[model samples]
Target: MDIRIGMLGFGFMGKTHAYAVENLKYFYKNLPFTARITALCTAHKDTSCAACAEYGFDRACGSEDEIISDPDIDAVDVCTPNIFHYETVKKILRAKKHVMCEKPLAVTYEEAAELARLADEAGVTTQIVFNNRYMAPVLRAKQLIDSGRLGDIIGFRSAYLHNSCMDPNKPAGWKQTGEYGGGVLRDLGSHAIDLVYYLCGDFERVSGKSLIYYRERAGMDGAVWKTTADEAFYITAQLKSGAIGTIEANKLTVGVNDDLSIFVHGTRGSLRFSLMDPNFLEFYDGSLPGGDYGGDRGVTRIECVNRYPEPGGVFPGVKAPVGWLRGHVGNMYNFCSAVYEGRQAAPSFFDGARISAVIDAAERSDRADGAFVAVAQP
Candidate 1:
């Protein structure tokens, strides 16, 4: 099977997805299908045309409709702005095409829910780009949690922070504007919320607070403008399984760069992971017997590294250190494989909608002066 993707948007995520598709075979041996980006669609025609020629795409499309309606396109890979997701995804599903959408599925829960429903009715393979879940250490953490090593998860704290938004003089992009759904909450909070929800259970209730440390900043056009979105978000949530934790996403952190870390505590053990230390997982076993010499009571660093499953691990070797991009590759492989096998992918639109619902609830909570809000069911 040849899984040809129609790539929308020629930005950061576009390049990332393209790299993932182009390099899948090298990392995963004995792939069941050949996956490639066959068409390119961008905000500008010239750039799209140039991308097609440079990246070996067969065609350059002026609009998303061209790619969505293309007979040769097996899937629509959405890497466009947050504001474009709902409509683009609806059209792709209406066309009966598979979709690989980036995170925070839609700007609102209603839109996300409708997309999830449409995907289900279409019976098309779908995946949301919660790429962090593909990290080896993160996967290992899931394995341990499922195995009951961290018996009955009770609490967790996770945060994703960056310092890029701290400088008021820096020109802002679409992400810093409210109209395009730009904000740290939806940008980074979506990941943090998903990470916790993936390990913990469904959210029961949440209280959230948003802050805008820098009220004024240069807009995309370099004009001084008032900030319309949050620079940081703090959330306190209760899970359906009776666990409670704090989740945060902040861009005003003075000295942070792609820093995402999580600490999960349970009845029997605890697990810690940091994106800064991509190769290992820190685990502490409360079940370890106490001794006068403190025998085996300390945290053990498990070297998860690039230890992907068969068809992977071989390229970089299991012992090799994997970086952030490895997760994207793994995520792409999973989606493509599911499509080829005619199976629904994990982290599907359902997962995306659920996360978006939590986000919506959190925003409402922020507006209500940090009052608790219930996450709506999909």
Candidate 2:
């Protein structure tokens, strides 16, 4: 049985979902069911329809409802704008379909919680597509942390710094507004928080600041749009495990490539992971004696394996030297299989909702001038 996936949204996330659908069977073994890109949906009829044809979708749907109501599709992958996630996801779940939505779950905390609740109530399986968790090196890092190789983590730093849209002339879209999921915290910090939870434990508290680097930008309609959201975020958090950490993300970083690195100092050792060097993880063990020796503290490259099942080719695995693009594809296969087979999925919507709550707490803390705020654990 192949799980039929209908992807909605044809932008960055749309193409990513499509790529994942197009490459699911090339990596793993024993997928409970086969997966296929059954359809594509977008608000625009022509552009979306063209994308559907170009991407080899079986068909193109004109509306989110059209895709959700299509019984032939087993799941609807939502890559649409964050402001639309809550309503879109609520309807999809009501249609008794599984979903793999982009991060934040919703543009606002209330909406996120409602969507999370609805997904849970529907019991139809859902994931928020925290794709970083699927990164091979990140997985290896988790394994190392679980083994206590990093010892008792005393301090941690996870930052996602990139310079993709630093220019004022970059124009305004859904991401530039404060209300429409338009902020640095929700846009990028969500991933950081999720990574924090994945690598370490839940957050005990977080206190930080978020700033909108640019005040305004050109709109698609050649009008000036307010850039009320932060282009960067700076936050310090306390993990429930007693480890304090800093999580920062900036779109203003010059010459950055989606750099997400976590530095940890433990009681006995330390380890680090940078997304640019996705293949290898770096670890320094203080337990080993060093007698006046000069050693390199460079990060070790642990290439990712991209072997997947039939039709899921080039999917993410232990293969080192893999890229973030492959991880996106692998994530689709994971969620689709989990939905069809009635099993587990990584970074489920609950994880999404929880991280959203963390962001909410951070916002509260920011309002209070960087006071500690406890994160709710599910």
Candidate 3:
């Protein structure tokens, strides 16, 4: 099977997904299907044409609609701005094609819910790019939780932080403006929220606070502009399973670089993960025997890096240190395989919509002065 993808947005994630599709064959030896980028579309025609020439895409489309409606394209990969996702995803699913969207599926819960409903009705293969979940450590974390190793999860904490917004002199990009659906909460919080939901369970209620430490900053044009988006957001949540946790997203951390970490504690054991140390999952087993000298009671660092099951971990040795981009490759490979095999991919748009619903509640809590807000069900 040949999976022809028409990708929108030639930004950071757009290029990443393109690389995944192009390199999947090398990472996973297969006798099943071939996935390739057949077309490219971006905000600017010149950029799209240039990308086509440079990246060897078959067609340089004028708009996303052209790519979505094209019969030759089997899948529509959405890597556009958050504001554009709802409409573009609807168009893709309505065209009876597969869709692979980046996180925070849409700017609002209502829009994401509608998209999820339409995707279900269309019965098309869909995936949301929560690439962090594809990390070997995260996968192992999920396995341990599911197998009752982290028995009866009681509480958890997660954070995703960056220092990109720490410098007041730095110019504001689309991510620093509210009109573009830009904020650390929506950008980083979405991933953090999904991590808790994925590991623990559905959120029952939440209280949130948003902060803009730097009220004004340099604009994209090098002029001073008011900051309209949150530099940090703090949320405290309760899960349906009676677990409570804190989730935080911050862009004003002075010396952080993509710092995402999570800790989960349970009655039986605990698990910890940090993107800084992406190759290992530190697990604590309370069931283990403990003595005065702390015999076999300390945290066990599980070497999970690059140890993917069959079809993966072949090109790169299993013990090799895996980085962030490897997760994107695995995510894309699974989505394409799902499309080809007529199966639903993990982290579907429904999962994305769930995070949107939680975000909606978080915003409500923030507006209501941190009053607990119930998460809307899908």
TM-score, structure 1 vs. true: 0.85
User: What lDDT tens digits, residue by residue, belong to model 1 across residues 1-378?
Assistant: 999999999899999999889889989988899998889999999999999888888889898999999898999999999999999999999999999999889999999999999999999999999999999999999999999999998999999999989889999988888999889999999999999989887999999999998899998888999999999999999999999999999999988899999999999999999998989999999999878999779899999978898978777777557665668779999999999999999998999999999999999999999999999985
Give the residue spans of candidate 2 off by over 4 A. 294-320, 323-378
lDDT of 3 by residue, 1-378 (tens): 999999999999999999889989888877499999999999999999999999999989888999988999999999998989998998899899999999889999999999989999999999999999989899999999999998999999999999889888989988888888899999999999999999998999999999999888898888989998999999999999999999999998888898999999999999999999988999999999998899879899999978888787786767567665668779999999999999999998999999999999999999999999999996
Each model's lDDT comes to 0.93, 0.80, 0.92
TM-score (all chains, Cα) for each model: 0.85, 0.78, 0.85
Worst 10 residues of 3 by lDDT: 317-326
Number of clashes found in candidate 1: 0
What does the lDDT come to for candidate 2? 0.80
Model 2: per-residue Cα lDDT over 254-355, one tens digit each: 888788888877887777888787666677777766554545443444444543234444344334346556587699999999999999898878888998
Residue-level lDDT for 188 in candidate 3: 96
Worst 10 residues of 1 by lDDT: 317-326
Query: After TM-score superposition, what is the CA distance of residue 362 in candidate 2 from its true location, in Å?
Result: 64
Candidate 1, overall lDDT?
0.93
Residue 161 lDDT in candidate 1: 91
Stretches of candidate 1 exceeding 4 Å from the true structure: 323-378
